[model samples]
Target: RFMDSAKRLPNKPMVVFEGQEWTFAQMHEWSNHLAHFWIAQGIGHGDIVCQMLENSPDFIANWIALMKIGATAAFINFRLPPKALAHCLRIATARTLVFHPAFAATVDAVRADLGAATDTAPACPPWATLVDGAVWRVHPATPPPPSRTAAVDFADPAMLIYTSGTTGLPKAAIVSHMRMTLAAVGFPGMYGVSESDIIHCTLPLYHASAALIGFAQACFLGSTVVLSRRFSVSRFWAEVRESRATVVQYIGELCRYLLQASASAAAAATTDHRVRIAIGSGLRPDIWEAFKRQCGIPEIGEFYASTEGTAYLFHWHRAGAPGAGAVGYFGPLARVMNGIKVLRVDPDTHEMVVDSQTGYGQVAAPGEPGEMISRITNEPHKRFNGYFGDASASEKKVLANVFSDGDRWFRTGDLISVSADGYYYFHDRLGDTFRWKGENVSTTEVQEAFEGMPGLVEANVYGVALPGTDGRAGCAALQWAPGHPPPDADARRQLAATLRQRLPPYAVPVFLRYVPQLEHTATLKQTKVALRHQGADPRVCADPLFVYDAGARTYVPLSAERYVAL
Candidate 1:
């Protein structure tokens, strides 16, 4: 693949990372260097290397190195809190980690916690630490290809990725090499990516949307990639203009943020002649048209791909119409299920939901919202990388013995509806995750902020009811340990400062509830259900509750009149 692209279009730009440029030759060399780094360390086939860095040139280099060696790579999100991050690294059982040097403190915090992999992960941090290590020495020479004697089939497990568990513990998804290779080719062809295209990659490397699949598509087409340290709405168009990029890899919320940025209009106007395509997922119906208008983009290639299941959907037919239905391209098995499949039981007997003319409750209609269940026929290119064998958790999302007596399928904890024309439409999503301003707002991330505030010891963050809202509004409930200081004005200031720096504004809790105590589950879990009911109720407690004050740009005491518009 590299030789064909290199020979056919050797001079075309391949990658621009940080401030450095990597043409086809350079990127190929870098990938080879990383592969050599792996071999010198004796990390060969069947080994897993954990990646905890954001999307950067190094991240891609390391990932490509693993791919070349036939080793598995587990990409872990860098935004995870210390505890959550440690838990994932433990499961990865990776012998090496390539990360950013800036996160030294975070890495150090969990260094001792990594039980088995401690020896696997060098005590040295990334970049600054590894740059001087003896491992940096040039390899004697690229070793000869390993013998086929080991039976390293493409069907072997090559990657183990976990879902972005916004609710509880994240479940791991195991994907095979064959499935991934097919997926890689599926994306570029589905989206019409070609050697001439220069794609922008701003999403985090750890995410499935950005690194795993996005990078795959770029390489598959032998297209050039432009990388950024992080997603910066202000700098998006500037970079696009700079690189003369033809396409951008995006997740819908990133587009929304670009639309929301103060300079969106001006920046977009500045680049009237550049950027023709956008390929990504999560573009919502409400903001679809406005997003296209503001960005001056003509074509949108969106795909819906689940981590485990082989099925996916892409939107390729309509150049101007982006993200209004199921993904239309990217792979063959990815298809839209026809109707709402529900079950029926006798009203008195109440055995199950009756499958009559209604054919089990499938939302309002094909166009209306309904449960989206995908068939698991176990196609060759498609495999069910079940949730690491989490039987109950996996079962919870699947509706068994439906439609037919003995058929089993995966039930996306999401509610989707297919149109009369067989186009799938967005309904409601039924899971711990809820979309806010187009971004997946993790409650765990929100609550973790208050856990370390000087005035607080524990916090319970969850979504609350709001009129004319999609899922819920963010609310944080807090309790002060006796010795800790109370949440006063200064503490509120500190709280606000920390959140804005660590999290996006939308993910920040809108309402804060302070109570003498909090409700708990039998396992002593903070029962957010009761708190969710209490909402921003000023009467929930006499202590204090904080609601974001739009006018003041800071949270203020909650009041009855204040919630009128809520």
Candidate 2:
């Protein structure tokens, strides 16, 4: 499909990076040259090639070249430490690795542990090569032999994208060629993207959102994509205006950062840019309307899907808001055709609650939250491909005899509630929900409430283990808005009073920590694993700590003695 599109629209601009544009013909020729170079290096069909380059035109070209030669590209997160990088490379088992010069120090740090196969000995083939200016400089100027991508099977693995590894070491998810093709074609139809549209993509190319949805969709539609090395709140609008982008892609945190920037910075930013649609995931409900209104975006195309999940939901809000705070909308026809089920489960154990008589899981009633499980059929596209090189993890995601004797369903690991009008809203992740004061508490819900408070830029809510406590206690780490001082005594008292009135007593946070900034993963998702591990110990954490003072009706500083007394 990509090659056909390139042939049909050779002169159309396909990629714009760092003030340079590459037409479809130019991109095709460049990729063909690199494809011939890789074929010369003995890379064949079914072989995996690991990638650790930043977002650039070279990264996109290399990916296209690998696809042309029928090789799977394993995209490693560039920010990974040496230990984690080695683990990912070992799991991939790829014979060749390609990277840019900017990451030479990182590659050198792990060179000793890369094994003998990657060494430069004459007896063994070279396993690692730098693609900055040397490899592409030597490639032939002509196109490669007739296209080999056409002969590739749809079910064949095209890429290996690893998870965020929040719980443990990252697991490689197998993305098939058919799935990539579907994202390229399906997303354009979902947003009504046209050939004249120019998409501004600031997300990292290593993520599926930027690679498959942003880049691939532009290619499929014969449109233009404005690429950035990474997302920057300061330069986002400026770049969009300069590139004349009609569509912008974003993650939730990126939008929050934009909202938290100084009014002067935002005032200087271009709001009259040609951005008609903004599309991505992770937009919180509290700031959804505010972000659109502030940025002058007319439409929002929010979608819900993971790298490994088989089911997907696309919410198009071109008209007035029908499904507020919903990841997607399900019409009467969609509800019947998709057959999505929300099954009740034990929140603490995360096990399905089964009926004794029927011996099957019971579905949740309307307006009740439950774990969503989508039925899988014999169709190839709907089949869950499972994780790469990990059968045990893959089998854990499949539930057998879910509704009937031989029925199979794919567990989404997400808790969602459906309204009476068929709108689906995300509640929280399966493990992120915790029990506090004999009631269930959702971290996302708490985080959303925190976003509405004044002077708070970002909030990360998590349950932390406490001594002499039956369950985990709620702790919130907050980042103040830029140029604003930390909360004072009166400000803290007001915040506590507001939260008490807005939320249940059990759901209200018990402890608060103030920091200048919050850490995030490479894909721009706020991380909580490390914060949860650190707990609320002042000796372990460098951030300022505060304890809720029920008697004083305000938050007080936590001294060493005060921490132990609680």
Best by lDDT: 2
Each model's backbone clash number: 16, 0
- TM-score for each model: 0.71, 0.94
lDDT of each: 0.64, 0.84
Error of 1 at 65 (Å): 1.8
Off by over 4 Å in 1: 2-11, 116-134, 140-144, 148-150, 262-273, 317-364, 389-392, 432-534, 537-566
lDDT of 1 by residue, 1-566 (tens): 55356556656666788667877665566666777778777888888888777667677767766767778788776766788788777767788766676676777788778743333235554322363235644753332264511556766766777777655556667777767677778778777777677888887666566655566666667778888887776687788788788888777557655665523266435346578878887675555666676677777777766777644666763554433546442221333232223222222222345456845432344455444556666565444557654766666655556666666666665555555555655433444334566555656557645544654546777778777776567877787867776767766776777877777888888888877787642112345655666677665546587887756667777787777756
lDDT of 1: 0.64
Candidate 2's TM-score reads: 0.94
Q: What does the lDDT come to for candidate 2?
A: 0.84
Q: Cα miss at 297, model 1 (Å)?
A: 0.9
User: Cα deviation of 303 in candidate 2 (Å)?
Assistant: 0.6
List pairs with backbone clashes in candidate 2.
none
